[model samples]
Target: MSNIVLKRWKRTEGVVNESYTHSDGHHDQSTQLSEVTLTGHLGREAQSPIEMTKSAGEAASNGGDDSHLPNTLTEDNRNEGEAGGGVSPCCNWSWMVVLGATLLMCCILSAFRCMGMAEVVEVTVAWGEVDPTFVLLRCRQLLTNIISSCFGIIFSPFLLQLHTSSTTITIIYSVLQFMWNSSGLFVGPLVEEFNWRKVAMVSSFLSSCSFILSAFATSPWQLLLSFSILGGFCYGLMTSLSYLIIPHYFTRWRGVANACVVAGIGIGQMIGPILVEFLQKEYGYVGGTLLMGAVLFHACIGASLLRPIQNQTITNTSVQLVEPESRTSGVVTAEKKWTTVAIRIFLCVCRNIVTNFSVLKSRRAVIIAIGGLLTFNSWLNFIALIPFAVQAAGHPLQAASTCVIVSAVCNLVTCLAVSMLSDWSKFSMKGACMTSTAVIAASTFAFSVVTDIWWQKIIMGMWGCGVGSYMGIYGLTIAYYMGVHSLDATLGVTQLLIGLGFITIGPIIGVIRDASDSYTFSIWVLAGLAACSFILWIFMPNTTQHSHTTPLSPIT
Candidate 1:
């Protein structure tokens, strides 16, 4: 009888295990039997053994380790686990690190805007024997914008101290800017391939060296070599890396993240002039430049904090896996001559360009790019001319600097507020952008006609708001329509296109300043451009309904 009872029990256990496996796909017979035995202990729980078995199977399938399986088998714990595994919030520590570092970079770059060519031109005229002509000054400004916008500021106070002609300085500056901004194209691929921290380290070293070397330069060519070429290249590397890093740490609040990073420029603008002014007074330009080098070295710390996200997309994984194959194949064909290698590289670049052009096929993308080009051109033109306009109005250097300070402060506040609003509110990005463009146009026109310092301050604040609004919204707008994955390539293409405006507008403004002996005509022209940008935005599709609540997918 005892043997008969043991056989019956064994048969019953086999039936329960088979039923559990059939009901749930989890084939872990041991785990299911343990759960069934535990449920049987609670006499009432025996009635729901199947339900318990299903929950256990789910917990196991979800990749819960043996230790966590029992606790997370509950519905609430499973839901919590899912929420925790999703994209991290913006306020997390990792994101904070990215934000802090980006802000510092912005502050550093902002110094360039404050170190305006207008001030440099005045110093050249006052201290040097030969005054640089309007054309020469214009060329210098253009070159500065092109090569290293930051170095233009860093070296301007000292450029007049060199024994080179203004024309020579202009040429060197342009070469440097060209090297710096264009370097972004080359660095973008490396950044995508290797670790960004390595890029940041190299950039910091180059930038620091550029500043320290600039302090000892005595000729135009030397300045170009030290500050323009080397410094410009490094700056481009850092700039591209910064943009790429922010996207990795954010998705839901990307607009806010970008705004925070951009707001650092305002911080730098407000403080840079004061810092440089004080340093120049006590240490001279050479000593001040050396000090600037020390400050730039800290950027490496920020770069070091960047950790790669573990949840990489399948496309990224596949590319990484194929990289070794490509490298191995290249080694196998190492007998190829240099010319063949060069041709292959050129063809590869052409292919990439062709791939990137796919974005232009979309009407919405084209509209955004065009509007971005116009808005970017208008804002940069206004910034480049602000000090000149103020000085033209017969204001003191201090007053002009104060105008920059006020605008910078306003820009900082507006950038943060606008980004937050876009993330939280129901307002349409298109309408907001159009309204901001109109404000920019009107404020620029007002700046041209108004001479009173008080009114000029008001207009500068207004201009700052408009600029902040457009910049704050533009990135989010692109992400909304095209998706976040397209942002880097799209931005890169847009930058290249707008560079044409940068090269052409400065010369035109220079010609106008030379002909009219004032910035009135140039300011009006910029205002008109801003108005045109506003009109372009009007035709842009309304994206209010698809705001922050929607999940973004690649635009393929």
Candidate 2:
């Protein structure tokens, strides 16, 4: 007769969930059991959820025959399930979504980083003699893609014709930067109200419109309307939405998924300059602006790929549940009740904003935000600084561009490799952040002293390694520190910090270069910023304790 027996079989100092059927005092068929069930049985035997979950994961990973287990046991999913109060399985086709996201990310980053940065150089060249302040202001603003290709090319001629002062241009871009950064605050509510895919599609279409509007802009204010206000808002919306979509699809490969998506930024950085340069050269800036609009419009194609996952249970506490309104016996006319509904909605929104802002109260969120601010600001400066530094060291502009490409390649590779390692191995997210920041500090210091073209390329590669590694884990770090539910709010806070840094410190770097007539001091300052971020990261709270008190396990 076939019999069922519940047993915890320990072999050579490790636990394995196997059901051995014993009949007639002899063993017969043995079948593997689910890790979730195994953990529950162990839990009754006084085993902590964290310890049992980790042991089960280790056993599965350490060559245990888990072929019979469900495929939902993804890399980060274990922790996600434990913390979330139930074991959820990942969808089998999630990889298809990842592929789509990578393409979407490529288009987003290309427009946001690559095209934005290139436009600054193109605009300056087209206008031929502006205040040194214009380059500094626009370069920094464009880092987060406040300006697009069409935005700059269209505005360059108008500014020249109108004789607008650089100070006025700086003020305009500063407002754009603020708008871009502040728009993040609204993302969480928008995503909650609408499907993420719908929000992305609408924003992508509007972003393309912004670029097209810039191509025909006649005045600086028109440029602001098309490029600064509209473009900046759309970019911020799309960028935040991209980060939010990944965690929903893949818990098992969350780290690797983040790396793959962010690698699009590297790809865009590498390809954007060359493509825009060719378009502007071949078609002229006006035609280039129109062509660039055509390119930005393709983001809609990327947005179309973000299909929503079905049949998933969301246990995240951050996803607030709304209660249905009670029915009233007395009928109220629509016009009479409109004001009451509007007032109630406004009050509800205010509560959400207050609750979301409370995420900043956690030390973990603050450190993540501050560290991101320092590291990101330092890297953006490097993008603008590297070209000037190379020229200062006697290399041509071509050499500088080549060095930027080298950094991008290294960034892409390291980002992928490190993210995979973090998933497959026991490397902590905090450790990855610390190690990469140190590399950036050392590389930046070395670049300040090195003059040879080969050394510059090598130094740039090292710099990219640090930047990419940090970026790879940035989203994971947020999910780890705070729950995934708080990700939008935390990301919004980080964007605000980075934006403030751009406006305040970006121009200071330019002034230092101009006054000192050397990039050496400015480079040292950036290295110092990297060092500061490393130190700030060292204070990150120990989240391991949460595994015991809560069902979630710390991400390995």
Candidate 3:
């Protein structure tokens, strides 16, 4: 028979209590970091509105029984270590797994663009027909990607608070993979069907596969369609999920953990294309395809490792409602933590805008807007402009593709350095934003003047580095600002503008390069934007100083 008792708890006031079971007749003896078992809902203990604050955090961990209430095991009620073992091993893996998966997600995200926008430029130069209308194709692909991302994120809020197993995430991932597998056959049919979600899923899967087999497709259409479907849609959603997966499992170091999450996409961006390019040349497109699909399979299987503690949805059931400070007169505690968080986050951003009218009145919104603006440059230029950047520097097709490899590596290194340092030094997270903006501005300015191949590598890689760092901190910023509860919606609100930034500027990037006979002006325009980021950074408050005073144990 299973019994429930509070084994241990980290009361927010700052103390930890442990209850270890003394073996009687040889039952297992053990200690839990915090109450992983949720007997009821979260609100049961709220004595005041201030009780509305987030529960004391737990160990930064994942893998528990979602089938039951989270706090089933209490400190006073220690589980016997058990003969066959009751706890699952999946949740015990370090945060590094999430980081590795995220990096691949980033690479898959850019894979499609790398193929059509980046690779085609190379393909055409090497062998044959180039679309004079490449600019038009570039715009279409980018717009589709942005729109898909916007909608994909729209559904994310619901999923963010829900406890899904790696199994659930993997199933979704597999459906996405099917999309890619079908892309070669269903390209025209997909356009006709008009079911964007299915098409989007299929596309996302294919894009992930592309990273596994980067050099498989031989034609312009193959590269374009694969990227548009797989890289744009498939990779995009999976990357988004990387954010959701974290809060469900780990609460401590949420921001730092998120940095690694963001870093995943960065690493993927770094690795995806290089592997594809190498495999494609070494084996043929078929061999390249198989290799990439296999890598994606590995990632998909890894996603399966995540499981819901208690094995039940936290929401459908009830939580014990405490009289939270945010509550009115008499309120019962028994709501999902998410229900309250959603309300708190939306209000926070809106209130900050109202109370800090100075932040609102000035270009702070624009500075915030700049973050969205920068997101557009990564895949957009990689697809349309970087190839040109490569050609302009006088490299051959294969060698020019190496430029992306360089850009990827630099992005990974810089983001890791920035994130790890920020977490260790406890620097303000904004320090990262400032650092990225500074590097981007300096690099873009230098890129505008440099024409030598080696110089191009340095400058372009620097630009990519800035983008990667920003991506690394993307969710962490929201986590820091609105707290983890507002993460999805804040991302939603921020990304709408970000999507616009991509939509608005992608064409101009192409047009400027087309009209000027030189990329000098375009690089400068981006450089100026990067500088504006720095100016905005000046007005932003420092986050490193935020107090980390909560009791360091799992919420009982």
Winner by lDDT: 2
**What is the Cα-based TM-score of model 1?**
0.69
> Which residue runs does candidate 3 get wrong by more than 4 Å?
1-118, 121-234, 251-299, 311-369, 378-384, 393-403, 543-552
Residue-wise C-alpha lDDT for candidate 1, range 354-413, written one tens digit per residue: 455455555555777777767767766666677667777899766766776577566667
Candidate 1 runs further than 4 Å off: 1-97, 103-107, 110-154, 184-187, 277-287, 309-354, 391-398, 543-556
Best by TM-score: 2
**How does model 3 fare in lDDT?**
0.43
TM-scores of the models, in the order given: 0.69, 0.73, 0.54
lDDT of each: 0.56, 0.62, 0.43
Tens digits of lDDT, candidate 3, 126-222: 4365432343223222211222221111111222334333334323323333333222222212211122223334444555565443344443334
- What is the TM-score of candidate 3? 0.54
- Superposed by TM-score, candidate 2 places the C-alpha of residue 444 at a distance from the truth, in angstroms, of 1.3
Arranged by lDDT with the best first, the candidates are: 2, 1, 3
What ranges in model 2 sit over 4 Å off? 1-93, 113-131, 140-164, 274-291, 304-350, 545-556
